[model samples]
Target: MSRRRRKSLPAEPVRCVIERLSHDGRGIAHQNGKTQFVDGALPGETVMAKVVGSRSKFDELRTLEVLEPVAERVTPPCEFADLCGGCSLQHMAGDAQIAFKEKTLREHFAHFGGIEPEHWEPPMRSPDLGYRRKARLGVRFVPKRDSVLVGFREKRNSFLTDIDRCVVMDPRIGDRITDLRAMLYTLQAHDSIAQVEVACGDDAAALVFRNMEPLGSADYERLVAFGKAHDLHIYLQPKGPDTVHRIWPEQGEERLSYRLDDFDLTLKFHPMDFTQVNAGINHKMVALAVEWLDVQPGERVLDLFCGLGNFTLPLARRAGQVVGVEGDDAMVVRGRENARLNDLDNVSFHGANLQGDFTGESWAREGFDKILIDPPRSGAEEVCEYLTAFGARRIVYVSCNPATLARDAGVLVAKGYRLVRAGVMDMFPHTTHVESIALFERK
Candidate 1:
């Protein structure tokens, strides 16, 4: 058997009028009786787009010239917005971005779940720029350019974009991108450095370097010196995430922590731990989840996919008792430690895979009046069956992917739970990534 060859891209730029926006912020257009998804183009705009890829049903293009612009289109703040793939809707106005995300959530709910929310909560928002506290930067040494690039991948390409700064990232690390690039170029094992994982706390920032090769003594000294000068905590991971360890300022605190001032809670986590990238939105999101869940002082609450007790600890503050369950044992331990640190005795944590048959687990048999779920992109399909078994009267679902949330909503609705309220959160500004929350109550 032979595989069919992909069609070649057109050489000349084609003129097209963008009819609508796709879920990922790409503009939808039709040309030559086929659909074209153009990057950097907005709806109601006419542009010249260059074809870069071809598929059976559609072709992918990049806008080269915008002959007519739409009112929602604004100048991107980042200098490398055109080349960097870090953000998609940077050209769209901030207010319009929120509206677009809310619309996306609604569309997903109606199309996949076959229902609409009874109450539409106001969109949770935060600062548009310098809001990202966590990110993974691509590092590469290009011999042709005789320099090292330390930033995100280029748009529609795997190559690293030569960016000096990132507008969406927290300024503590964003402003140091050029310095990091220059530092990498000076290192002997520059080519061995594959990526940099950034994690920022309230007061300090940490960078974990994923190195493919061992560094020399001089290189180690230079990294330490750089960390000291910039007030950054540095870690090196020669292999997997478990191997990540701090090499600089070895005596002080290596843990990164953030505080929810309203709850008087401080949560500590490692550099590689799963956490919200936007700190501002996370603080607001937790408050909103607590409010919508309406956790009472006498109610028992269950928190699933709880990481470092971000929501679990806060829920414990309000509920009489809360049980936090996570898949990773390490996170469960951290969650317990966070509970202890906050001096909360009403919360406990357990490690169990929520995606599998969790009915045999000890926590599964417990009864609860309220439940909170914060699942990843895949959603909580496997665990929805057990909600009613716990005798949960109220459930609040915090979702990072709207499509999966909608699918699970259908399951809950079938199980006699009514979708009372739903809304989007601006966790990732200037990007199509949608984080949402919804409340469900027994009919």
Candidate 2:
């Protein structure tokens, strides 16, 4: 061992002006024919960054200082903007962030898919602050800090940041951060509590606490009392997601819910349901998808990955028949219930694994006139292929991942579909998250 000497890593400091932002929010920079991805530097800014890591293609650096600040850069309003890993582009101006996102969307569509939308709907904007309706916050017992750390993850680390408040959360949830911490601290097994997932809508806000063990009697009483005092609903997760149950009030069932005004549907969901994190952007997204689909009376439509009938009920209003398909049976039951609640007979829900074959005889002859897909970040590549022969004249693809959207779009284009229009919606405002809708027509 003494005969072999280990080589130390190279120390290289690169100073460069950020030219643009990548999809993941890293500032792209180039200098002396080498490309560098600098963290914490915004576009159109000069900064000195110390090289922390590098790959064959790109170099990674942490910004030391902004030698020259861009006009679009501003002091982030949230005390946790840089510290909280939940959002990255908060320091960039709202308008500039939207512009960058739009440009990025367009580039993805054209460059990756080799397809161009003939028209573009202006990017939908939401209240730049206090808009997040869903979040999973991390909880840690930091003995050195003499307080429980309750917040999101720190930048580039799994350790939870000791955040007192989050400005981007809905006012109701944002204001309760300190109270939640206090209450959690009172629990008998405070060290066993991991994090709390917060979901809010018009009428109710629910906090689902994920714990490693069941709560003791004292802990249960403290949580229930806190919930009653704040008019909040509390759910406890002792094990897996199926184990999540309401611990507050000791009795009665209240389903967590969110309303989609554009859809005219009030969806009842479990505390653990997968709903959009941004309520404002979700409403706008439904409206945009409906508008792009151009639903007409007597037209049959298919809504894929339809969670709780977000777009299905809205489509039912304008189309003769709307079929909502989801992988979760529980969600399908809720979706059907929502349709019945709205008294919409034209909407039908089916539970099927969307990633699998969806073009069997029973699924093949649906005769849909239009289709709407809001798949997860995985994108609906296989589902897009299955829809090519479904006789849908128009298809509206709503995507949360631009790269996967671009890949699926390429598949659609090759199958005689033309991208008619595409646009972005600023859903997760402070974060680098991109939500976009694209319209494709059979050629």
The number of the candidate with the highest TM-score is 1
| TM-score of predicted structure 2 | 0.93
Choose the strongest candidate by lDDT: 1
**Model 2: per-residue lDDT, tens digit, 237-268?**
99988888887756766577777765567877
TM-score of each: 0.98, 0.93
Q: Model 2 lDDT vs. the true structure?
A: 0.84
Q: Pull out the clashing pairs in model 2.
A: none
Prediction-by-prediction clash tally: 0, 0
- Tell how far residue 191 is off in model 2, in angstroms: 0.4
Candidate 2 weakest lDDT stretch, 10 residues: 1-10
The parts of candidate 1 lying over 4 Å away from their true place are: 1-7
